[model samples]
Target chain A: MTQARTLYDRLWDDHLVVERPDEPALVYIDLHLVHEVTSPQAFEGLRRRGLLVRRPNRTVATIDHAIPTHDRSLPIADRVAAGQIEQLKRNCTDFGVPLHGPGSGRQGIVHVIGPELGLTQPGMTVVCGDSHTATHGAFGALAFGIGTSEVEMVLATQCLLQRRSKNQRVEVTGRLRDGVTAKDLILALIARIGVDGGAGTVLEYTGSAVRALDMEARMTVCNMSIEAGARAGMIAPDDTTFQYLHGRPFAPSGRAWDEALERWRTLVTDDGASFDRSVEIDGDAIEPMITFGTNPAQAIAIGGRVPSPTDVPAADREALTKALAYMGIEPARPILGHPVQTVFIGSCTNGRLSDLRAAASVLRGRKVHPGVRTLVVPGSEDVGRAAEAEGLADIFRTAGAEWRAPGCSMCIAMNGDEVRPGETAVSTSNRNFEGRQGRGSRTLLASPLTAAAAAVTGAVADPRTFA
Target chain B: MTPFIAFESVYARLLRSHIDTDQIIPARFLKTTSREGLGRHAFADWRYEEGGQLRPDFPLHHPSARGATVLLAGENFGCGSSREHAPWALLEMGFRAVIAPSFGDIFRQNALKNGLLPIAVDAGVHAALADAPPDATVGVDLGVIRLPDGQRAFYPIDPFWKACLAGGIDEIEYVLRQAEAIADFEQGAR
Candidate 1:
């Protein structure tokens, strides 16, 4: 008998190569993306095994994390870092995988390039050596991050042995209020669910609120799913998704497009399909939220205060206290109006053109507050070009924010752009864990508008006031 | 020869979801290339102060957590960033096994490579581990895990990976053992 199935189950079952009922099943991968940070060891593993990548056509490579965004010249200043990048290029060439290195117009963050080049599409199983691989789920694909050994495994076998996750439906209904963008919506979701809310599930974001978001915005939401402890996040494909794929470099055209769309249309969860868990939120109720403490879940509305430890669950009270103590925040204190030393408006989470345009709208005539350093790093070369064409870079520069080249900059501090010790930053990136931005550096996660406002005010201020 | 896998028994209680790589080993500790000494720095930010002294306020630093090895972490336990240092630090910290509802793809592979067995238990089992005391002891077989109270669960492991782990074999050793098979196949195909 045919059983009712959700989109996740359909995809899971289709990809399953070996099903050992009680054990993880080996699922096939449609695409494998590699980058500088995690590819080194996997290549090393391959070298140790004296094995070539079995399926070079299915693999792609890029350099972003450790490569200096400003300097593209060879022999990077940091010898060790330079070696890793060089090794990756060599490995990609050796393995016959396409490598988008510096100066390659296509070169950018793996997540950014994937969609722009139409490499990410619906119903495909995409694996990358980066956590934000979930960003591709914006296209209705089953994408997740893997490690070096898994990279090697995919190289050798083109499959991953994974246990299926229960499906979840996070329905954000109603139209978003004006000035509330995708970043705000995701921050609001994170706030409601806490960082670990969607654990053990694949969150299928649906409803009018999700459908209304553009492709870039959808990516922003899915990119932060890892922050919510979700295995991955996805949205049902629609006209918007198909339109974004049309005429792209790697996307199919003509008959293939028709075929792909037909398949994608069926990629949505069946109407009667049940979810392990479901949550509903009103899009109108969401305001620009910002994280107050270390975890993304430690967030509140832009005008809200740092929650008192007592207000939190007893089990989480200690963590709140520690985060507050480490952040130099007090219980019940207003965090929105708290001052910040810097503003970072970039990352795989919110580094697309739309994100920059949204931030640019807020910074048009305003200047970044004196003593607050602001930086805007685009997600990719294409995004950077698009922003520059729209004069978004001019607005940022005029506002005293440094517009940087494409790379994962202050996002993880893997590169040199890091928040100084003990200084607080309002960032549009994911993860506010201790030392995530830098050692002893404090991070407050917020929407791009909120970060822009913090740049202008030198403090975390409500963006709604400026709006 | 089989790989020299240094096996040790661990019994750590699980931390809730989203234990990111940054938290596994902070950025400051990432300056060095050598994987040695990472165990002491594992969870350094959450475990101790700048002076290397234990943070009295930290939960894992409490007396109750002493000698714990097997960690039962929440779902998506090593989510965010593919920093191999995370698994390196966890393994070096003397954690022989990590049981979670789900593990970040890269973190799981790195854990396995470093001889830190990542066991995926049911959501209920994970919640139980989180609710259990820090001193709760759990047994970690290759793909089967037994909780402190004797509840047992079996998780799937790739057969190829299972053989490697069972024989205490590293990736290189596994490849070497199959060299003859690979050569024979290549010759026949040609």
Candidate 2:
């Protein structure tokens, strides 16, 4: 008899292209997503080698990281950023790859476009030059980030030499309480595990709370898998996965849809399958969470205080001190009500339509704090239209937030939009790394609802108060 | 391109953990596709003051640490974005090997592809090496770390990766080496 297998194992095994004697097997890719920041060199390498993109139809390109998110009519102001965006368009055109450029109504963050267009599906193996490619694993796909070198290899051959990572399952039980969003849940997980906890491990988030989340919420969780050092994060395909993919543009149709559904039905983990490691958490124990330091791992519940240097291990003291110094905050003090000069709600992590709705719900009647400049950049053009259709943009605009075009605006500050130096921002993007938003800019990462609450109060306020 | 069989060097102990790729090679220096000019930019933010003077406190700037080819980084070195530029910049800076308690996966792969060795030693070995006499020369092999006193500790590595370093071959060569086997698998699957 055969041993039981996990959904990851099933997907990985199915995609195996060729097993190598000593290295990991080279696996075939089903969908390859490309973007501006990381693909320029990969494409240049291909051109250097006189190689052609092996599977152009399977690949999709978009302008996100380097493209200006405001006033698309005008040329990009920064010369270097403009060149990166232009290089991508030239590469995609030369390589016969479809591009979602400015005015395509499809241009957006790579992670957002893949799923919103229904290109990401259960059992598919996806690779993107960007690390947040793990976001697609929310649909039970075997997705992970690759460096630019690997992107070149994939573009040239449509396959990757892989060493399979050990599977580790994280189970969240019970239900999340009001005001506790997916962002809070993932922040708490990273804090518990530390930054290197998931190193070399493929994290599978399971149990009732994961099942309870919608597609966007699941993406929010999987999106941060890299933050915990996990190679990838996934959830098994189920009713939510099927319903979400049912009518999307790239989803299978008619007879093909029935066949696809039948196949997806069998993509669950077998009852007796074993994972290398397992973690169980009480979901109700989580609260609206925020990161106070340079790394996403240095986080706490909103009601909690910054961990004193003494509270950490000896190896962490210097880092904690540097983090607190950089953040310009005192240790051992309550994190609540810290002043924020800016508020941003967008990124591959939390820029979906659902995230906007959550923020709009809080800003519907309230005005933004007098001292704060607010930005509500959508993840994709599609999400932008959806928000406008629902009058979410009206709420943001009426509340004095700048509702702008879709892209990774202000998330990594690659575009012209940036949080000025010394300004503190409560942003919904992943990665609170030092200087990530802008040089010397302090960023406190929180859920959109928390960010919205902070926007109105000009401090880190609990969303529950608004509730 | 001979195998990276063994080497001995006084390790530069830069023990800060989670030194992400962005720090190793910041985005500002990433515009150029070629890896030639990245050496001077490696750890630009940390190794130099904003006004372009070297910070005497940084280990790389220490009087005796110059020309040290091996790097002793903290746990989770090369985390964050999947940039090959991190390893490219390090290699350009004359580092042939990096030793750590852990490493980010993509960075390790990138290092190997460029003939740079990423050694993941156990915590005991890492701590001992971190505390190794400031000018002590430590030996590094495929699966072993040799102390100055001729004692050795073992660390696990894939035989294939060992052979890749040993043979000085890239992934393309590895694939070509298995061409016949791959063809057989393809035909059978069809």
Candidate 3:
């Protein structure tokens, strides 16, 4: 008989290539997702070493970070950006790696396209160079972000030397109330635990609330796990995960589907399995949340007030003071009704069909505030086409928001889509770090619904008010 | 990769927590393919003012902290983004190690692979290091740090990584050595 093991334990055991005492375990990688920005240098490393990508068939490449999201038909205007994208294209062609470039209908954010194309599945190990690669963990895979060095290592050997991380279970009990979203729940969790709460741990999001979330919402919750400083965040695969992956292009088919489901069903943690650390939150008490400072931990409910720096610990007062000063927020004032200059609705975090639909629902019979500049960028071309088919794009355009192309637009500001300095943006993307949206840009991290409400109200407002 | 060497250097202290990769190397400067010449742009936003001049108030620019190769940072240093450029910029700027209470997991890995040591110290030891004068020399050897006061602390690192650092060996060759085992794993995985 074996001791009760966690989902992470199972995944680790299954992927172990070489495990020895006094050394990092070498684990096999199932899927490797590459993008232009991080892969150029990694490929250069490979070229310099005279090495070949060990498993080109298991690797997929795409352009999202440095490619222009708008008017893909036109040539990329920035020389450096063009060079990076072209470099990835040439590398993919030369290395026999599959690429979903501009013309490929599969082209989109790497994290987005992975799940949509079903390359990300249960009982697998996924690695990418972007931190948001943890977004795929929603499918019960042991996925994580690696640096360029590890990226080159993976390309060269299809394996990574890793130390096993401690297990931390983040359990959200009960059901989330109406208007409270996955994004809001994650924000509230980060606020409660602080930024480094999950350091050196792999978080298993469990309990009734996490299980109740749909596939897209689950991805949203896992997407921001890095913001909480977790090595990775995962949810056990169940019916929702199976249903989402069932018929996608890369998913198992026919007889293979039955076999895959059998293995996925066993991916859950066994009863009485214990974690090294645990945090429990009441989901029903959560409200639509927003960030008041640069880090995600400095968040508040939509109706809550910006906390006073003096009220925090002496050690934390300085950070709070600097954050409040940078964000231009008055302590103890309600975060609501603060004016926003831009509203961006896209990223690996929330740029999905359901997220766009939720935002479109808010703009169906309403117009955006005249003072607000709203950019509605989908996560990928597949998401864009689906939203267009469902008339969500029309609602956004009719409400005065720009329905742009599919890519990681203002979320990264790498493709010339940016919030100007000194401007405030209400964004659904994860991370509100200084200059994340743009230099000197003040980003208020929120849900799609909250971002949509701000788009129409031209200020920070509760999505429940519109509801 | 450069071999990790034991050396003594004055440590520069920046106690701001959650010092993210975005601050270390902003996204705007990430367009380049080459990893060279990034030291000039390291901490570009904080190190430089609006007119392209170095900010006088920035701690790294202080007279006593100049040319320091070791950085005493705050908790969760290198917290955001998995960009290897963060460690690259730090190395280029002559920083051989970062001492902190904690580090973002990915950044710690990136630093070690690039020969930039990430040393995790307890809050008490970290506080003492922080209070040390910028000009006080600190010693760092294999898996151990010697503070300005001569108090020693041993840090934890994987034996394999420590060996690689000591030998200045590229890990790719190490991984390549196990290609047959990797292929065997793939065969069984299928």
Candidate 4:
């Protein structure tokens, strides 16, 4: 008898090596990504144990968070940050793991570098130390974030003992209205399901709306699954996925590609496969979204009014009130056209070539308000090069925006690129918590196009108007 | 080595979910490699002014919440970044136990190593505790939590991690102490 299966079951069964009752199962990792921020301690742990990386070929390292994008030369100003970067290089060199250092052309955010290099393919298990590792799920992989200890485990064993997660399918149907992008769709999903909606589950995003999105857009949707407490988020491999993987550096070639496609064809959930829980939303109902408070879930449609504390459940009212007071936002007021002092467009979430092109389309022949400071940091060196070659950089510069090199610049502000205190920025990066950008900096999360529009208008303006 | 878990008392209600490491201790405060004195800056943005004076608006700095050791937080606590300073600052701030519905995987591991008890309670119970008065005293027994209103509930904890937290043993020390047992097990299997 043929076994009935879901995509999660198929992937889990394929990766499982050893299973013990009441104990975690050892599942193999197909790909491992490392970065400067989280790998130093893991490497130290390995050295202390006198173990070489069991499979260095399976791992790839990059420097992103702490590397300054503005100055790509040696001698980073921050001594501690420079040491962390130096330690990562030494560790990768000692272990035989490939390192994509600053200005390496391949160097960028670990999440962005993985997909662009074609190292992340469909139906593979990808693990990284960064939570945004879910970005690889755009290729229909089971990618999740691991801790430093788990990173060390993967380095030594090429496997992790993990408890399986339940399956969930979030079906988003109907065409997304113009001005709405993948970023908006994800924000709406979090708002509807709450932050912990998919806890202990692997979410499979399905339906026409998902299928219609490009790989970059799909990545933006899956990248925030961790924010929703999901183990990972994925979409079924389709023509778009195959096309995106066809010419990449590490992607399978010719006959090998054919064989890979044959396997990927079988990677979808079977008909009638039941999910532990499911949710359905009309994509048309979602508008451009902007976060008003700390949590990603504290968002509403761009043109929509801020929610009153009374509108929320009594149990959650106090938190809502606290968030409003901290953000200095008035409840029941429209967030549309709120004045912003700065705008940032880049991150693992939406710093791909397509994201840049989309923002450039809105920015062309327009100038940013003189009062506003707009920064466009590409996700990786490869993305930065591609955007510059495509004239997207010129368009951004023409529009009074600062076109910068690739690094996780202004995204969480660990690299010294930060929004000034109390300055509200329309940001494309994830997380808008107080001081998330800098101490006392206010962030309003939006799509790249919306951020571009905000930069030009010096306020939170609708991107659809430009479209 | 006997596990020397020293449980401190926290006297305030913790904030909600996604209390990320950045908020626990801002990036500016992370320039030092030494893990000492981070506790004083725990929740620095919310707890103090730019001038380093305590902010009266902060929940932890409130007069009613003084000297409270057991902190009750919302679900998916510590949800962003793998900064160990988060748990370090919490431990230094005298938070012995953090009771929440869930915890970020990295933060949970970091907390265990730092002798901070991360107690995972039911979501409904967490909600009830969040609704509890800011000054309400809740006892977080690693085994069970007793509410001020006489309501008591048992919470599930991973026994291995539980032993470590109770003994104040970290993974490195635990593995070192069990070296003989591990060696014996390997020999017996061979």
> Model 2: per-residue lDDT, tens digit, A91-112?
9889999998878888889999
In model 1 chain A, the worst 10-residue window by lDDT is A16-25
lDDT of 1 by residue, A50-84 (tens): 88886798798988887666656645677767777
Best by DockQ: 3
Q: What is the DockQ of candidate 2?
A: 0.48
Score chain A of each prediction against the true chain A by TM-score and list the results.
0.97, 0.99, 0.99, 0.98
Per-residue CA lDDT of candidate 3, range B1-190, in tens? 7787799999888889899999898887788888887898888878888789989999999888888999999889999899999999999999999999889999999999889999998988898888877678889987898988998988887788889999998888887888888888888977
* lDDT at residue A11 of model 3 (Cα atoms): 96
Residue pairs clashing, model 1? A23-B156, A24-B156, A147-B106, B10-B69, B10-B70, B11-B69, B11-B70, B12-B70, B14-B72
TM-score, ranked from best to worst: 3, 2, 4, 1
Model 4 chain A: weakest 10-residue lDDT segment is A17-26
- What's the C-alpha lDDT at position A303 in model 2? 94
> By TM-score, is 1 or 4 better?
4
Predicted candidate 3 versus true structure: per-residue lDDT over A1-467, tens digit per residue: 38999999999999999988988899999999999888888999899889899899889998888778778789889999998888898999999999998778999999999999999999899999999888999999999999999999999999999999999999999999999999999999999998999888999999899999999999999999999999999999999999999899999999999999998899989998989999999989998999999999999999999999878899999999988888888999999999999999999999999999989989999999999999999999999999999899999999999998888989989889999888899999998998888888999999999999999999999898888
Q: Tell me the TM-score for chain B of model 3.
A: 0.96
Q: Please, what are the lDDT tens digits per residue for candidate 4 over residues A1-467?
A: 27667788888887876566765566778899998876777788788788788678889999888878785765789888888788888999899999998767799999999998999999999999877888898888999987666777778777776778899999999978877899999999998897778778888999989999999999999999877878889998999999999989999999999999999988999888889999998998889898998788899988899999989888788888878887878999998778899999999998999889989999999999998999999999999999989899999999999998788888879888999987899999988877989887889899998999899898888888888
Candidate with top lDDT is: 3
Task: Please list the Cα RMSD from the true structure of every candidate, rounded to 1 decimal place.
Answer: 4.9, 2.2, 1.1, 4.1
- Candidate 3 residue runs with Cα over 4 Å from true position: none
